[model samples]
Target: MSIWSESTQSRAKEILAKYPEKRSAVMPLLYLAMAEDGWLTIEGMTEVAEWVGITPAQVQSVASFYTMYKREPTGKYLVSLCTSISCMLLGSDDVLHAIEDESGVPHGETDDEGVISVEHAECIGACGGAVACQVNYELIEGLTPEKGRELVRWLKKARPDAVNTDEMQELFGGRRSFDWAIQSDVGAAGPYPAFEPYGTATEDAK
Candidate 1:
């Protein structure tokens, strides 16, 4: 009797098939569901659990583990900035300050307009890029003082009065990856699945 939509139910089937154990798909399913609906309601989890043939407990546990599953709806742009050792050493603190100063919102707080949410992250795994921040899961790296400012300026100009953009464009200095964000993995990138070069980010963009 759980009422998941036709599309979500179809995706649930695909996700379940990807895993030998149905339990393993719980997290990704919850993530997809939440991405569609914004927050992980108990009702939604129960519906997804029933679809995946897993206990509600499994669904709940999985949802709780990833920071991406918002218990509460977040801003239009969720900015997760890396504060790890490499980023920290490379002036991520100043970067953090720039973001805070420009956005006028404290870390872990959402702006009243609900346009952006800022939070600290452990690592984004782009150590070679030296410093980075994510806007709605798009990784922008090789941040210089001027580049960062332009990014902020550009974000402030987005329509619906948004402070983030969908395209993510290029860095102010252009693609800095050399092969920029490029890597090889049996003719593909280690972290990239679709085999595109000049693209990377450490985590799930969640």
Candidate 2:
């Protein structure tokens, strides 16, 4: 049996049709697999290999190269605190420590309940909003130690089905990277891109 569901299979076909070469579809297909399992599983990789006519090792190589692809199980909310120059200079370190203290887990580890995972990221491309972090890859800017702790506590307590980016920014973020004209309701569920609009199938099934 295939790992992909009926909808995912159809979506995969659509993605493959867009690319001239099947190999070019590897990245998007990998995202699809990650969305299915929350992280890249061996079976999912194997299926992707079959779809793209590549070896499983080759698929693994691609997945390992990108930090966005989670090789292991991650919490529902992946909190990636930026530790790059701009963020570090603006007190990202203190914010990171504060999150660790509140979540009771060090960087690169998940909480006891597996709801939140904390990690130090190099640069999330939000330097304008220094001291930034991404919750499930949704940017939350201008985080202070207090706001960092509050963010984790809120995730643990609420465990909302969807984590709205705009709402989070308004509540916990400050200093925008740029003026935003459009609004989005997309909620990220894990490290990888959520294939569906509202969220991944895993989130939608719930």
Candidate 3:
């Protein structure tokens, strides 16, 4: 089910040795594999389980528990707008709708052309940014419905190969791009910790 490369598989094997809780290594390994393959396949997670001396079930559970591990293919630009409470109160729902209108894609699914896909997440730890998101792994904050539309247009123009919009080329690219993270207490009060970075495969595990 995994689509990991030979190098990644070897690295996962090496990193697993240093962990007492094999589950602790699942996230980072999935991230590295996804980074290499652009998606995490069932086979890929299973391979990680094998390397880590754990069952495939354990890996699957860990992968499914976290939203950061992508189980499907993502677009050239990943627009992860925050639709959580703070963002919702700030009109993030409208922002999400505008993005959907522009891209013709929905949550948890990729577009037909795979240009830009949306993944809804709870507070990206930027309540101050309010309705902000991370695009292409780059954090973007200070979101508005108009600004969101402008972003969709800009990305379309920047990568014409990624979308079908001549109008995008006409839109302004440079200007006030929003800040990524804002100081906020929203993420801090969340049930889960936000600083949980995924594990990656290392040479020692192999």
Candidate 4:
């Protein structure tokens, strides 16, 4: 049986339409599958492969290489703490421990009800915001141990069906549509030639 729903399949068609080459749609399709299922199951990977005319192994290989794609089931909220040099100096370790203590789930694991999952991550590129953390891949900068605990509390009470805060709309909102990413600007915004022909400069020289 197909894991993809009818609506998801329709959205996949739209994403595929964006690229001239079908293979180029693989990443977006993979993200779509992850957003729909919360993790990339073998079935989902296979379906994506079929859509892009690639082998399942190829899809799996690509999926395995990216940290953004989760192989195991994750909670509704994924809390990732960055403990790189910059964040560690600012006490990211304490923040992680506080979350583990408050939620009773260690790193790489989820709570009993699967409300939240905590993990220590490498630099997430928020150096200025020391002790940076991510809830569902959205950076929550300048966090403390207390803040982490508060976040866990909020996530526990958060309803997926309820309206999410502006920062979290993407996660709670159903499957993502890439319609916003397609560029519509057609003006001559750059110095480079927009049309294809023999170079004007070369013709002038001749």
Candidate 5:
């Protein structure tokens, strides 16, 4: 009856231990929830709030502020096409339409089957690879309308082990592995709380 499975809950403890305070793990825990459910469901956020000693509303506020976190269900693969200035000039708009037509899923929405979700991204820092598209955020550069269509089809049919590309490997590597606790360092000093540092990009330019 809990949003997190027993194993996931155990992992949450590990995540908590990494920080000086449980609350510091909120973002990673949110990612854990998203990684587990493929999106941040209400129940998932509630569970994370409980784990991090925060209110559900606080969790929701943080989740809503971040574009990377999805509040609804997403397909197994999330395909994001960049449509920024450079990408737009390079025909990413056509590429986006091609994917939309082929998948029959509109931008910012997932298909009913939950196999694919499509969205337009501002700039994924790949202007050199204009018309860039990513499958689950793994870069797939050098895209054309036709190539985008084929890429989606390939993703829908490709088997995890049958693939050898680094992108494919990373995308499927931990599709179901939600063991965030294992990566924590428990020996560190207590109160090693995580902090979100804020600084302007130009600050380091001098």
Candidate 6:
């Protein structure tokens, strides 16, 4: 049986059609696969290889090269705290420790409940924002240690189906890289494809 659902397979066909060579569609197809499984499973990679006319090893090579691709299973929310020079100077390390205290896990580990995964990220291009982090790639800037702890505590307690970026920024953000448009009800569960969570009412409508 194919790893892709019918809709995903159809989408894959459309993505493949965009490229002259099937192998050229590997990246997008991998994104689709990741969106499907929430991570890059061996079976999904094999199916992608079959679709793209490439070896599974080749698919693995490409997937490994990209930081966005989640090779293992991640929690429902992936929290990436920026620890680059700018964020570091602004006390991101303290924020990270606060998050660790609240989430009960160190960076690069998921909480026992599997609700949140915390990791330290390199520069996420929000230097102007200083201390910044992303929840499933949605930027939240200007976090202090207290705010970080509060954010994690809220996430654990609320377990919200949709995490509104605008709302999060309004509540916890102090500085910003730039002015962002209000995004209502938009939520992300991963780092790729920029889509709402797969089975949400928003995604279902799309």
In candidate 4, which residue ranges exceed 4 Å CA deviation? 160-206
Better of 5 and 6 by lDDT: 6
List residue ranges in candidate 2 displaced over 4 A: 195-206
Estimate TM-scores for all models: 0.74, 0.92, 0.69, 0.75, 0.75, 0.88
Q: lDDT per residue, candidate 3, 17-125, as tens digits?
A: 6688776677767666565655677777777786666898888888888776777777766777889998898788998888878777786677877667776778877
lDDT, residue 183, candidate 2: 62
Candidate No. with top TM-score: 2
Question: Candidate 3 has what TM-score?
Answer: 0.69
Ranking by TM-score: 2, 6, 4, 5, 1, 3
lDDT of 1: 0.61
Instruction: Give stretches of model 3 more than 4 Å off.
Output: 1-14, 17-23, 160-206
What CA RMSD would candidate 3 show? 8.9
Encode model 5's per-residue lDDT on 1-206: one tens digit a residue. 45777766777777788889778899888877765676778988998888887899999999899887888888767788899999899888999999999999999999898878899998987677677776655555667887788777876776221222234323322222122233311110100111122100111110
Q: What is the lDDT of residue 202 in candidate 2?
A: 38
In terms of lDDT, the poorest run of 10 residues in model 2 is 197-206
lDDT of each: 0.61, 0.84, 0.61, 0.67, 0.67, 0.80
After superposition, the stretches of candidate 1 with alpha carbons farther than 4 Å from their true spots are 159-169, 172-178, 181-206
Q: Relative to the unseen true structure, what is the Cα RMSD of model 6? A: 2.9
Q: Each candidate's root-mean-square deviation in Å?
A: 6.8, 2.5, 8.9, 13.8, 11.3, 2.9
Quote the positional error of residue 183 for candidate 5 in Å. Answer: 21
For model 1, residues 12-130, the per-residue Cα lDDT tens digits are: 77778878888777766666555455556787788778867887788888778877677666676676678899889888888777777788777888778766677777888766675
* Higher-ranked by TM-score: 1 or 5: 5
